[model samples]
Target: MNYRIEWKQILKNKEKVQCSSDWISAESAIQLGEELERNGKVTDLYFYDEMGVSWNMKEMRKLLLEIEEEPHDITLYFDGGFQKETYQAGLGAVIFYHQGKKKYRIRANNLFNEMETNNEAEYAALYFALGILEELGVEYKTCEIKGDSQVVLKQLEGEWPCYEEVLNRWLDRIEEKINKMGIRPRYTVISRKDNKEADKLATQALEGKEIYAKTIIL
Candidate 1:
């Protein structure tokens, strides 16, 4: 959530103005508005998010408070693969978000040889994504976690029972991490075609290719 301040004309008497900042974490907006009012630069202040959504002082304050303890909408895609011959695993994720006026994507992948099964690899991939999101400070917003694997999605959503002790442990860890981050995970299942970018990145990891990226907005 990032914002910029702008002045505009609204109606005949109301001055149309916008403040630039991440409404996802709007604590600063209220303070900034009060400071502007104190300075006599503006009688009142209004905040608009990157989406041009306007919020009043009270509403903005409430959102900030909630966000301080909760997460907002963040999209995460996870994919992974495993090889039988060497017990090698590869994982990938693509995190996309828009806060304030900026849109960002964080694409990442990892290679590990210790994983025993595809399910573990998939969970590890999702974990890799969470690590990246944590680095980007996304724990402060809501998260939309997407994956191509139905097994992972179903288990994460508690739609299917995970009986494997190892996998169950992984599931618990994932949930714990999400909770610690204050993330509200909205899990969804997408077809492989829809998750091509992340799938390709995961395959690249299997091929021993290094990971690359554009940006990971915090």
Candidate 2:
């Protein structure tokens, strides 16, 4: 997680002012906070996360300790493929995460019969990824959501306007689930070539070749 540090700065003339450091990772903030404590200049240490929530040194320590036993950083790549012939949408997701010092990847895909447009299918792919996060016990953490669909990425990031009623519904559901899980989502749009893993998964699902695996990278 990322956080900004705030402290009270007192001048030699007895003038008091509030000072803040640039946004940095939570681990760095904790290290800096500890240094301040040792120097006896710890006036007020506040750690502000990306979600706008503030945490003290104690809270930050506790959260980091919990994360040390499991992965807290996560990234998800999603892709959706729709076949007009069968009116079936195949949604796929590739998730990368860490458990302690070990890295792992998860590949999953599912098929939907109701989605009409390619945009709707893309949204379904993201929703499917979120379900996987829940299953992995990810909560109160940030997850990078990457996709090749400009429509889905731009609309979700509020950079582009969504006009379709069906797509708006999908948008609402995605936002609701993010808030419910206390997940801070970072959206990134990449090229189709960069999303080949999830793209292949979607195609495999369309062909009824389901892929669901979790493997560790030693």
Candidate 3:
């Protein structure tokens, strides 16, 4: 979890205004808070997470204690291919995650004929990946989402406006799902050439060759 550190520094028998720092890792925030307490009196020491949930030091420490010793690191790559003649869209996703001492990668794909355009198909492919994350029980963490579709990535990131009604609906649904999971999503737009892995999987989907695999990295 990431937290913004906020506290009041005592100065000359007066409490200065509360100061806040940019979000930092929870572990680092805790250590800094402890060090501040040891050096001198600090008042109103607390933290606010990315979702704006406030936490007292005691509560944060307790929660950190409950978390696994190893941290969660997850990345998702998605691509979509649409055939105008067939009106079929192929969606593909590659997910990499780590837990304890093990790292794993999963590849999956789907073919659907419902989307009307390639942009819509791109959004659908990303949504499909969210479903996979749900199956993996991912929640309350930061996830890196990368894709080749500038429309999908920029719109989701609010860097570009989405004027299409269908795409707006898909955007709303994706936002709702990720918010419900307390997920902090970071979107990166990559060149098509840089997204060959997902591109290949999407082609395979279009060809009726489905893939779903998990491989542990040694």
Q: What is the RMSD, in Å, between candidate 1 and the native fold over all Cα?
A: 8.6
The sequence of per-residue lDDT tens digits that candidate 3 reaches over residues 1-218 is 57888988888877577777787877788898888778676788888887788889899888676544433578999999998889899999999887656788999999988679999889889999999998888888789999988879888989899889999999999999999887899899898988889889989999999999989988
Rank by TM-score, descending? 2, 3, 1
User: Which candidate model has the greater lDDT, 1 or 2?
Assistant: 2
* Candidate 1 per-residue lDDT over residues 38-93, each given as its tens digit: 65545335677655667666777777666544334578999998987889888999
Looking at candidate 3, the ten consecutive residues that score lowest on lDDT are 63-72
Q: Candidate 1, TM-score vs. the true structure?
A: 0.69
Worst lDDT run of 10 residues, candidate 2, spans: 36-45
Q: Write the per-residue lDDT of candidate 2 for residues 7-106, one digit (tens) a residue.
A: 8866777676788888887678899888877876557778888888888889989977877676677999999999988889999999998878789999
- What is model 2's C-alpha RMSD? 1.8
| Per-candidate clash tally | 13, 0, 0
Which portions of model 3 show Cα errors greater than 4 Å?
12-17, 66-71, 100-103
Global lDDT of each candidate: 0.77, 0.88, 0.86
